[model samples]
Target: MAETLSAPALPSVYRQLLDAIDIGIHVINHEGKSIIYNRKMSEIEDMEKEDVLHKNIMDIFLFNKEEESRLLQALNHGEVHHNAKQVYFNFKGQEITTINDTFPLIYEGKRIGAVEIAKDITRLERLTRENARDKQDARFTFDQIIGDSNAIREVVENARRATRTTSSVLISGETGTGKELFAQSIHNGSERASKPFISQNCAALPDSLIEGILFGSVKGAFTGAADHPGLFEQADGGTLMLDEINSLSAPLQAKLLRALQEKSIRRIGDTKNRSVDVRIIATINEDPAVSLEKNRLREDLYYRLSVVSILVPPLRQRKEDIPVLANHFVNKYNKRFQLNVPGIAKGVQQLFQEYDWPGNVRELEHMVEGAMNLIYYDERIDYTHLPVHVRNKFPSYNDISHAPEALVVPNAPPTKPLQEYMEEVEKVYIEQILKRHSGNVTQAADELGLSRQSLQYRLRKYRLNIRHS
Candidate 1:
């Protein structure tokens, strides 16, 4: 009697398991024909598998010759190919991008068909494109911050070095000096770049709310208490920038000091403490030492937070950077509003170099932006474009009673050449313009209907004292 042969049984969940997969999956026979295809694979190809069963895989799909040849070789060699790039042409005549991994199915040491798994990476590709666009839009770098003065350079150098460390940083600067920008740049350059960076203004919140906000409150902890994580908790594994930190109350300052020292926080109305890992970066308009002496800030907390301190110089001290900053703002607004208002005139540059900018760089930026909006095409900004207060503060060219008047030839035959007299007039006018625009060459050029390069040359020729106006 011949021995009876029994057919091998397939696993009960084998088909169900393939169908449940989220990724597209299919099987191809030795002849390169699709033997089985899951619903996802059929949908990805935009075709019904029933109509394409036993069809040549390459014939139904649109793949590069190189990729097709590689897949065929893999099948022939019974080798697995992971993460193969392939393009699939659907019934709708659309090219679908996909990544596939092919593996040969071996049974009893005999080469069978191959299983192919594919995943659509279109969303991931779109996300990458959007990220590139966002980075381009946010292009404020350390170099973009204008200021060649030694004071400003020192501040920038310290900031750059401090960015490399994980210690707490305290940025001290007057309002409008771009303290927040420095903080953001530090966070961007730090190891926690990918992590969340949160900022909170201590002056903006009340004492009661400050406590609940810094150290999150549990449900029913207060009148409107809803359980919520605080900024410290939310910024775990990242940086938390506290603006106007000196504004925090003395008692609340103690709580903050404790949290910093302990690296943990206790929720309001809860005794349990939750560990938190976050870097604290704080900014104060006033000196931390002075704030501590006044009892407005805790000395212990000030020392702890000021491990790395940076003091941004006021704009008046960095007068040389005025022209650079003004030009930057003009270009910014010109592109923003699509205005054709050309460069600042020589007169405006002279005024900018002379004006005492109390608000520093922030004031200069705003003044430039405001002037761009106020001026029109071919119209150079004159003394009138500047704010009345600024113009009134400077001494006019006609009001030089203390100095001896210019010697006139009276009836003497036109002694000095006309060009020399004209040059003298131009020098005086340019000086007035520089005084009017507060040392901003771009603004001065725009006001005088002259190019920045031309005004710069004239300024150097006249040997004018172009520092703070």
Candidate 2:
């Protein structure tokens, strides 16, 4: 009998197959005690197989009370539960994320324990959170204007103060500056906050149409006239933003001047002038002085509307605000997309600082949003995610080159002093930044790492107007 004992059988192929699996796998008995755990499961739990086997499943691996209850319910009811990319903390206190599928294992028409298969997905979760953050930063807000630069602060302070006035305000800046936003903020901060704040693009409509739209017409005043109230009448006791006021036709300009001077408008084919009480905020992209010299604008109208003139600084002028604007845009896009992008890479930040933003804050916003979407895996955005145009402009510090072709250099004598040449370069860069930040100096200053006061000094020295914020 001692010689007839059969040799111990080798492990079955099924057992070997279970042990070979890469994903964590575990089995619990009917009593909810761990019956078997593969190598992967032991690794995931940071324990030896001998330590986990025979231990209560709820007592060993389930960290949270809710998870323990859920596991018990699944085992008792012979149910299956699946969680895709769930987050957890392990025995070592390190955060772990996984996609898990759990199901009751039944045999011989009787409920056995349950088996759970889990795969680590911690990196995926982190990436998702980063994408969300980038979206959150990209949004537009009154606070998006970043600047401690004195010139920019002065403009913001003035704009904030002007919000309390009912006088017709003029916003003068280069294209891409946020003239309309300033107008809107003033309206929002004024007595007409709750009332309708209407906006009209004077450059987009014909003189007759502009006139008709500004002043209500009688039923038979002209073709298609059905006794509609004009924007001015509708906006009575509120605010009206006139965008591109310099583009107004001569005749329309004259009519507009008359209305502002008289504080009333005469409808077409009407003898009576109706008085309306509406605050006017006008925006002109071109320099008012230049427009006056070209005879494109009437001097009287300019003075009337510019009682509180605000000139917005462009992106290049307030380079200090770039980083702030970039961060803001990143946060905005992160929220919108529900991604967890951490922040811009240091290299990308450097590139942003060096590049000339001709398009201003609007351009920067678009670029940040685009980068968030483009960065599929990495939490941090690098220089590669930026638009080619932006990247191209920012030659590496090691690479020396002239400005891009799109950048124009005024013809200056070659014998110009080094300081004068540098000043010109600075002026161009500032102008480009202003255009990028939509003339928001605070935003530009944040990018350049300069105080608003310092930016103001440079602006004055360069004769750059800092009127809009």
Local distance difference test, each candidate:
0.75, 0.74
Q: List TM-scores for all candidates, in order.
A: 0.57, 0.55
Quote the positional error of residue 364 for candidate 1 in Å.
Answer: 0.9
- Top model number, lDDT: 1
Off by over 4 Å in 1: 1-140, 395-469
- For model 1, the local distance difference test gives 0.75
Worst 10 residues of 1 by lDDT: 397-406
lDDT of 1 by residue, 1-469 (tens): 9654434433435666777888888787878777778878777767897756886655454332325544465567766768877654442335566788978877888767778788877557658769855643222357666777788888888888877888999999888888988887788777887777888999997998888888898988878888889988988898899999999888888899999999999989887999999999999987767887898778899899999999987777778888778877876675566454556655667778888788878898888777777886435545666676777776482232232144332232478887787778778878877887899776787666664545666887989879621
For model 1, what is the error of residue 123's alpha carbon versus the real structure, in angstroms, after optimal superposition? 17
- In model 1, state the lDDT of residue 50: 73
